[model samples]
Target: MNIIALEALTFGLGRLAAASRKHGCSLTLFTRDKTVYDYELSLLDEQNIKVVEIDTFDDHAVVEMIRNEKDVVALLSSTDTWSLHCLDVSKSLGLPAQNADAVRIARDKYQLRNRLYEAGLSSAKSQLVDPRKFDNESVIKDISYPCIVKDTAGTGSQNVWIAYDKEDLLQTLDKAAQEVLRGQIAIEPFFSGTLYSLETLSWKGETRVIALTSRITSQEPYFREEAFSSPVTINHSISAALEVWIDNVLKSIGYGNGFAHTEFMITDTGFEVIEINPRLGGVQIGEALCQSLDINIYEAWIEMALNKRPALMDVPLNIHKGIGQLIIYATETGEFSHIEGLDRLSAHPGSPRFYPTAYSGKSISTIVDQRASIGILLAEGETSEVALLNVFAARNKIRVVMKG
Candidate 1:
């Protein structure tokens, strides 16, 4: 069968496409630039597959090309525009769509929150207040303390702020009010506690929790996500509770068809829902977790997308002693400086070190949410603290020199 896989971000979709080819399937990749095309070409070449490029998703010609591709059985996407493009193109053709309407709800935080609220799902009680309608001070008072101000539809924590006080809240509000911030922001109570993310697969009217990953964030105020690892290296009871909640959550959204990555918080009061994304998380943690635990999630996704019932691997969820993922960050955005302890980083007490693409003195920007991950440091140990120490030791070694 021939498949069209959207290649917009480094979402490990390319690998999924390649796996399709390895299993005697052909894939047509959609790309807009030579840089992305060349990168995808190199990777696809390894699997002996050629890519067909669509320079723009906005063109009618592109849509026609997608509609007319011979034997085009499925189309997969992970771009911000994927929900819009895939829905338009897939419907034009006679292909499957995960959730055309749900895609919009999942992509837009405002709509997502409203939907979740309407469904009576556990979430931070939020309001979508347009500043032009009311005063910022009144909005702050209306919500719970330690609230988060976030862009309605943004990724990688680009414009997310956790307001601590009135002044900071006002500043953040004003900054969000600029010309680029036409959409509304979420003023929700900041639910405190341990945060966890769950990946659920919906197939054949039977939804199951594929993997539960625990995300570790930077020490608050900045709220940058550092890293995430699978099996949630936490209590079994906690994971089980999450499983039950996740299953119901998707079923509520009418998602017994495809993928959903939902974030949640386990607090002393109870478990509250964080936002859920319709696509896979960008860190490629699902594949990483599968590798660490002897499971192949990407291949399974491909198999199911092609109408073939792919059996889920029996990944021993809690068998992991201590698996940890570390997100590397530049001290400042500048030219490539020097890494301090390469020997120490390479010589982790646990497993392997996944050094990101950044090298000494490479020019980098000073914004680290998810995309700013210079590299990933992973190591499994007897204890999470040991794993954390091992990761920190490696991260501390990298000395970056940004352009001044």
Candidate 2:
């Protein structure tokens, strides 16, 4: 079997590539030529994963190359741009794939919010504003205070801003205009709650929740994720209600195939759908799920895409261990020096998994979103509390030193 992955340099890409090898499938990775390619080549070499350079998604030559690739069973991508490209190519080739409209709705925050409102799946009030017309008082009047301004199709929380009052909102709008934001931007009332994500696999509208994760984000007004703990077991009643809500949201959004990383805000009143990402949850969520569930989700996704069959993994009735993931970000702007407490962190009893993404001697600035992540740390323990504690301890022990 053969699978084609586009822009496949995500943190989980290595594991996915390993899984493909283990499953006796040949993997071909297609990525654009860029400076980042330098960092990716070594990882690809380490995995023995094949890499193909493409200037564009569907240039005649690239399409010809894709068509000639033998025994192509499925297409995989973790990034938004290439995932949509995969969908387009899948459509062109008459392969099983997600609907283009579904992918669009999943990627565009404004479309997602509008569709949810139209389908009565959403309760939050939101508006799509033209960045050029952001200065109009009439347009800004409708948006309530304590709202969030976000790019329509952005990922990793880029160009996201929180407004606590009208002054802040106006200032944020000015910033957006100066940034020359692309497409329409969304403004929605910010909800205060505990954030959670449902990692699900859907096949022809039949979806199964694979793992439930609880998230910790940087203290707002910047909402970059800081930590995550997976296979979270909520109370039975809450879990049942959330399951129903997630099912309705997924069905309403027209998610029929592949993985959907659905995020939600659970509060005392109820739950509100945040955004439905049409890819696997990035960072170490995949790693945590693999550890807690004892299954390779990427490999399962490949098999499901090719065979159109449900993936049945050997999930124990009770998952006793908790896997926690922490993303370490730069606290100050300066040249990168070195990380502290590597030896102590590694030798800790929890046996945490660590991978630093930043290079020494490279410059780093304050992290406002997921893109600024310097490194990732994972720790597993007997329970969620223990895992979280160990992860927190490890994170505190390991500090990213910035040169003066």
Q: How much lDDT does each candidate structure score?
A: 0.66, 0.76
Task: Please name the candidate that would achieve the greatest TM-score relative to the true structure.
Answer: 2
Q: Name the 10 consecutive residues with the lowest summed lDDT in model 1.
A: 313-322
- Tens-place lDDT per residue, model 2, 117-206, is 888877765787776675567667867778999888777767889998888887788788776454567898787888999988777777
Kindly give the number of clashing pairs for every candidate. 15, 0
List per-candidate RMSD values in Å: 3.4, 2.6
Q: Compute the lDDT of residue 332 as modeled in candidate 2.
A: 76
User: CA shift at 73, candidate 2, in angstroms?
Assistant: 2.7
User: What TM-score does candidate 1 reach?
Assistant: 0.85
Query: What clash count does candidate 1 reach?
Result: 15
TM-score for each of the candidates: 0.85, 0.91
Residue 372 in candidate 1, Cα distance off native in Å:
3.3
